[model samples]
Target: MDFNFTEEQDMVRDGLSRMVREQYGPEERRQLIASDAGWSKAIWGQLAELGILGMSFSEEDGGFGGGAIDSMVIMEEFGKGLVVEPFVPTVVCAGGFLKHAGTAAQKEEHIGGIVSGERVFAFAYAEPRGRYDLANIETTAKKDGGDYVLNGHKAVVIGAPWASHLVVTARTGGERTDAQGISVFVVDKSADGIVTRDYATVDGRRASEVYFENVRVPADALIGEEGNALPLIERVTDEAIAAQCAEACGAMKVAHAMTLDYAKQRKQFGVPIASFQVLQHRMVDMYTEYECSVSMTYLATLRLDADERTRKEAVSAAKVRVAQAAHHVGQEAIQIHGGNGMTDEYAIGHYFKRLTIFDSEFGNIDHHMKRHIALAS
Candidate 1:
């Protein structure tokens, strides 16, 4: 029932906050994003040195044996810093799948590299037609001699530009959109017949439209049992949703604080706008939304180990609330900063753009609302 972080968790949180504050200021982040890789490998290595790259795994997997709460702490700080690193794609999404479904040898081979920050991974699950449905896979995987051949196209694969490996979903049995036939595979990024069209996204991150034409991998590339990856995929996706909600909370907190400070400084009618009753009321509303979002994020994270239904329901609820708060806080931040907020030179507009990306990723407000309603029914 207690929501307060334990000493260890607090330590990790504070350490990560201090590291980000000292290293990833707005100007530094801008320079990093403008670089060719669109992210900082130096910062990524520092995170590994700090043991944050391993926070989501267990001790046996070369991690600190932390859980969702630990991941939330690190991700919240990453969000605050507007990190362009592919931590979520590599450590959260791909690593979750590996930890839950990979063989022991697979774990050692893939997860070891992940924990050391030597390898980056992208979840190549999204298809051109797939919009939030985890089971909607159109890519086909067929049995070959001691291997599987994959052929399909994945859309908007975030982090693919920097990824050395990919966790891809394909149809091994049933029709597209059917849950019974999906499977997941670990594919090398430089494999033959693989073509990637990479570009920078609106939020200062990179993504790729990846095409697979007769891509072949050994049978050992399978993550878990064949034709039974739906359950695992769904579970990992839910974890990602929870993490995204937490990150959104962090971004919203920054946006709210920035807006308040701007209000206090920007004078109108010979007085600070923050002194105006209307602006004060708006700030109060932003704070209320942020606090509510924090409570919901914690509730969802605490419920991750509960029954599947309970956990998913809580995640959907938290995502819904977080999405609402993100929109409200992002817009208000921009409004408070006036025309200057729309410029790329200011950090507030960038925060708003990141919030907008968060709102659309995994699932949006309306998507989670429908999901929550379904769970309630």
Candidate 2:
């Protein structure tokens, strides 16, 4: 099959690339990260104006009718910039849920806002005790008359500080960790009984430990069926895995390039280190790892619309490969750069930190490996 991007996709990629380059230089990025909001709303609005936020939704849903590939394209570019915008949470995760299972009213109310970038969303799924398991939810949503009272803590909620809304997962029927009882809802972040303690993440992004204390949401907030949301969650998260795998690929590509540049410049024994075959070999390995990761990301992206088993296998395989590649590429880059790579002033260090965090998001190498093995068995 042909791997070439369509003209529109190319335009999208080029447009986003220019945006990142023009907007997020190293110094600019630091300022944005150090700001009180930890991200740039101006850039967010620019993305909306560029139609990127609406790229994945259907025209009927007020989007550009793009799909997994569009997200892959956008995220890879975001990775290159170390963008802290919540695209994955707002567009990929929340929009995926609305696209796949949301009621008509839900879509009408949310998708337009999402496409316009007026309603920012963070996915509140990872509980304190949940370690990469989508079903391992301890957050509870007890049903009351025409509403649900939520009570739980969502840990490491990326982009929660900037989100106007949250796509949250909670148990509404069965016991904890039970697959059948897990449900998803779209909650207002400013709702009463909801509290957030925000912090800057190591990757220069902002995140929050979100607490829900008897937070009441109308029944209309529920996204899918009352007690059958695990499959929906799995499918959306697999899509997220694929998107992030693409992101890792972008970071790895940049990291490898930085290492190559550094090796060519930094003199050792009165000669550039790039001339050393041992160091050259290590850089070559990093490039190889990056190319392989891009291939795996493509595999996962293409398989998103496949059958559940096939999609899971492909996503798991990509996540495992991408995670390992991110780790190797990052560590090798650091070692090659010596002390310069360890400092906060260097761009390489920031890239390394993002790659390190990428491994843990959605699933790590071992987590995907085990998931792939279980599916194969």
Candidate 3:
């Protein structure tokens, strides 16, 4: 399949890139990182005004009726700018989840606010072990009279500190890793019996550890049918992984460009370092890795709605390639920047850190490699 972007998609990317460059340059990013929210609400509003925040949702939900590829385009631009906003968690993960699995009433109630950037949402799936395994949830939600009582903890819920709501996965029955009886709930952050310990993540993102001690929610809060959320969760996770791979690819491209410019300008011994054969070879390798990542990301995006086996294989392959590419490109960019690369004063250092965090999130290279191999066998 041809992976070329349509004219409209290209325009969307270009417009976003221009906006980010003008509105969220390196200094602006630094200031946002130092802020309490680790992001700018004004920028978020601007994105909403541009219709980018609602780009991937249906028109009935106040969105633009875009798809997975549309999300990938927006996320790539966000990654290029090192945006601290919770676009992926709110727009891609939560919005996609609701669009796919939520009842019509649920979509009408929640998605409009999310698409308008008036309400933020997060996915609380990881537990103390911090694995992305959907079935490893120890959080329990027991059925009560007209409600479900949730009791347990969620670890490292990204954007939870700023989220108005969360999509939490809890075990309704069976063992911790059993797929059976897994359920998803929509929980309000301000509800009684809920506690949150907020913190700044390594990449200047806001996250929190949330506790639900008998937190009660109505039966309608459960997304889709109870005990049948596994398939939906798996599908959303695959799309999330593909979106992240696209972001990583975009970040790697930016890092490569920044390092190339540095090499060309930072002259040493009466000549630009970029003129050196060894440095040229290193740059070539970085470019090659980035190309591979782009190819894999595009392939995975196209397969977002494919058959189960095909989707799984494509996403796993993309995640593995993107992880490797991000690592190689980050390291090479840092190397090219020399001692200055390790300093916080330089944007390259921050870019490298973000790349590292991205590789680790969703699923790392090793995790995807194992999945890919298992599927192959």
Candidate 4:
């Protein structure tokens, strides 16, 4: 399938690139990172004004009616800018969860606000075990009259510190990983029994450890049917993986460009490094890996609505290839810059750090490799 951006998508990319260059240059990003929120409200508002935050939602939902490919474009630009905003957690993952499984009332109440940037939301799926395996959840939600009482801890909940709400995954059924008792609920972060400990992540983002002690929500808060959210959760995870792969592709592109510029300007052995045949070959390899990532990401995005096995295979393939590409591109970019690459004074260092964090987030190369092998077998 063709992976070239359409005219409209190109316009979207160009607009974002221009905005980031004009408003969120390296210095601005640095200041935002050091701030308490670890992001810029001004930039977030600007993105909303541009309708980028709502571009992927349907028009009836107060969005531009763009699809997965539109989301991929936005994520790619965000990655290139090293945007510290919770765009993925709030807009992509949380919004996707609601769009796919939320009731009509739930969509009317929450999705428009999310699309308009009036509120932020996060997905609370990870637990203390630090695994992306949805079946490994230990959090429980027991029925209490017309409400469900939630009790457990969620670790590394991204954007939770700023989120007004969270889509939480809890055990409501059997004990096995593939048990049918899994369910999802919409929980207010300010609920009486909820406690949050917030911290800064390595990539200058905010994450929180949230504890729920008998937090209760009406049964209507449950997304979709009771004890049937696992399949939806799996689909959301695959979409997240696809989105991350696209971001990795963008990061690799930026890193490659930065390295190329550095090689042409930085001198070694009384000559520019770009003149060296060995260094040139390394840059070529980086370009090749980036192309592979871009191709795989597009494939996964196009096949998002396919059957579970096919979707898993495509997403896992993209994630594995992108994870490997991100690692190689990050290291090569750093190496090309020599000692300066490791310093905070340089933008390349920050890009490398973000790429490292992205590689481990969602699911890493090893995780996707195992998943791919299992699916193939």
Q: Indicate which candidate wins on lDDT.
A: 2
lDDT of 2 at 326: 93
Which candidate achieves the best TM-score against the true structure?
2
Q: What are the Cα lDDT values of the candidates?
A: 0.90, 0.93, 0.88, 0.87
Task: Between candidates 1 and 3, name the one with more favorable lDDT.
Answer: 1
- TM-score for candidate 4, residues paired by index: 0.97
Report the lDDT tens digits of candidate 1 across residue range 16-111.
Answer: 999889988888888888888798888889888988889879999888899888988888888898888888899989899988899998999998
Worst ten in a row by lDDT for model 2: 172-181
What is the per-residue lDDT of model 4 for residues 124-170, given as tens digits with 9 covering 90 to 100?
99988847787787889999999999999999998888899998999
Q: Could you list the CA RMSD of all candidates, in the order they appear?
A: 1.0, 0.8, 1.1, 1.3
lDDT of 2 by residue, 197-287 (tens): 9999999999999999999999999998988999999999999999999888888988999999999999989999999999989999999
Clashing pairs in model 2, backbone N/Cα/C closer than 3 A: none
- Model 1 CA lDDT for position 127: 87
lDDT of 3 by residue, 94-116 (tens): 99789988899999988888878
lDDT of 3: 0.88
Clashes (backbone N, CA, C under 3 Å), per candidate, total: 0, 0, 0, 1
